[model samples]
Target: MNYINKITLLFLLSISVSFAQEKLSKEDAINLALENNYGIKIADSNLKIAKNNKSILNSGYLPTLTGNAGATYNKDNTEAIFANNEVSILKGAKSNRFNASLNLNYTLFDGLGRLYNYKQLKEQYNLTELQARETIEKTLLQLFTVYYKVALLTENVALLTQSLKISKDRLTRVNYQFEYGQNTKLFILNAEVDVNNDSIALLNTNQLLLNAKRDLYVVLGKKENPNFYVDTQVNFLTKLNKQELFGQVKTNNVSLLQIQRGIEISSFQLKANKSGYLPTIGLTTTYGWSKSNNNSASFLLESTNTGLSTGFNFKWDLFNSGRTRTQIQNAKINYDIQQLSKQQKELEITRDFNNAWEEYKTKLFIFQTQEKNVETNKRNFSRTEEQFKLGQITSIEFRQAQVNLLNAQSNLNSAKYDAKNTELKLLQLTGDLLNTEF
Candidate 1:
């Protein structure tokens, strides 16, 4: 009985806890978004299609075998004439015919076109995979940003609530002082206004937090409980070497690698097009059977045949009004354009890396500065509040100190998250974001 009661009590406690506010960590949010995001799902489907298209058979590198069969039946009145001028007529005749064939075809040589085509298919598959990875990286970044935004707003709401409490306490103190004729009517009115403003600010912050959560749900591609709170602490890399990072990004960045693959694919396509100017050799074999039966008033005849044959086939464009040449030239031009695109992508990646590095440094400095400001403001606000209580400072001065502290805290929060944001961008550029936990 005691064990059963313990189990029942634990189950109830678990249920109560589950109904409490949802707590989401940064890693959890990223994992959920990656699993459920519609964009990632679509990219995965496209990757599958590319894999299917990359099959060697689709590239025409494998032999093809096919089978076909047919049957026919006919009934007719027939008349025949012989060379001796004798004529004969049959009242009704019936005939049936059947035919079947199995055929095989394989490419013997095509100027190495099939080999190049197969290589292009492989490159295309690689491009698809790179594109999918890029999508995932982008989605993770967006989720991380929104998750931090929610955390920032949640902190703001907390600060404002604290301010509101301070204002309320001030109002009560002012009212009591006014009753005793120690404080002025103006002081009470001002305290009331401060309390009202803080209330309004807290409400607005709550709404903004809710909206941020909604945006997160969109990224996650699902609806979740709205009363969730996220971890507010922001983390960022403390040290980085720009040169080492740049070298890693040059080879690891998805967009850059994709462009490189594009160039390779275009090169293969150009070679395959050039093959059109040369002759193609192929082999074909066929095995077939046919049977026919006829019935007449006085006689019946039946015939059957079976055969196997094999041959080599050759084809050359010879000349097609320069069409093949035009195609080959176009492919070459595309290859050159892909090369140029690759160069452009490399430049862009370098620029992005430099910019992200600078931004990370700037935000780190700002966050450090804000951290100091928060500590100083906290001390100043504590001193001012004590002074106001002892009648050493005006209510207005105390309120000003409180507001300053709140602003300083808000700035610190923004700085910390912004630093983290830049850090994420740097990781993304270096192709390390996917492996690192936010």
Candidate 2:
């Protein structure tokens, strides 16, 4: 049993040594995640595609030009007879033909369809940008949540270590008292038991700290957990105004902006679909060169033509089995749907913001209360220790005081982190997280 205990102690010591090698600040962790996180990379790629799609060529604002060339060769046997009873026979006759052309087509008018299409493209690009920003916001929220969890656990471990130290000191003092015939064997055994309990608590907290660090590494997109420590202090905004935050949410929230853009895009789609009712006019021009040779022809042996031709083309869907009407109706319905979605999203965001704000305020109050409790417990423990030394308190009473202080400290640490996390949630709802300095 002693051997197993020694092995466990050594393993924990090794982990502690590894974890203390370097320090990682919150900003450094955020930067690492932005550079390596898979979700951010994918969002950036999508934004690039949306940007590329918002172009004149893709929106039908540019003319299309095409060049074509081809050559043909043929061989045949032919026989000819004339009305004057004259016959001619030709063998191995060969013919060759070549043609090339450059064609240009431009839309002269499409009942403003092209204009609406271009506007839709622009709105789509804006929507994608907002989507990417939302992705970043979400990723940062996750990163910070894990980062602070590690910080919280790190602080817990430190508190547990301090508690264990006090236990060990108490046990040593009890042993001395027992040797001097000032304390009973029962007192010594109780002290030893308290020491073991503190040791177990420390061990359990250390294990939790290690696990939290591993989770942080995963959030950082790291393949392996490195030997590093995080900042144990958690800082949060303390002076946020509710009205100002709500105003920012109205203007800066990514989800709201995306929904607004969707509505505009839908409106454009309805306009573009209505354009199907009007005639489409286009301009077409072609410059061509052709050459041909026929060995079996008597009157015309070789011929060539080169010219430029231009024309105007018109197309109107006079009757398309009511397809145009159906499309227009569908587009109008879609536009309505988008408007409803915008309203729904607005209500949802407002609800979420209200909830987060209330939670932040509540957590802040709890943290403040816990802070006072820790101060009070510290004083109580100090007095209890002095009383124990003067023989005014029992070992169990001193141990209880020590445990109370430890619990108070632990609760304070937890409340501090919880309040900080709630503040982050509020910032996220207002779309202020990315701009806030950690």
Name the runs in model 1 displaced over 4 angstroms. 1-19, 83-85, 295-300
Residue runs of model 2 more than 4 Å from their true location after superposition: 1-8, 15-20, 82-85
lDDT of each: 0.87, 0.87
Model 2 Cα lDDT, one tens digit per residue, 1-438: 663256348547866696557888988999998988888889999999998899876989899999999999988787877677888788888899999999999999998999999999999999999998998999988888888888888887778778877887887888898999998999988987777777777677767877888888887878886678888876777689999999998988889998999999999999998898999999999999999998764557899999999999999988899998999999999999998998899899999999999999999999999999999999999999999988899999999999899999989988998898889888988989899988
Clashing pairs in 1: none
Please give the lDDT score for candidate 1: 0.87
RMSD of each: 6.8, 2.0
Model 2: lDDT of residue 1: 67
Taking the tens digit of each residue's C-alpha lDDT, what string does model 1 give over 227-321?
57799976666567898889889879988889999999998988988888889999999999999897653244888899999999999989989
User: In candidate 2, what residue range of length 10 has the lowest lDDT sum?
Assistant: 2-11
Error of 2 at 21 (Å): 2.1
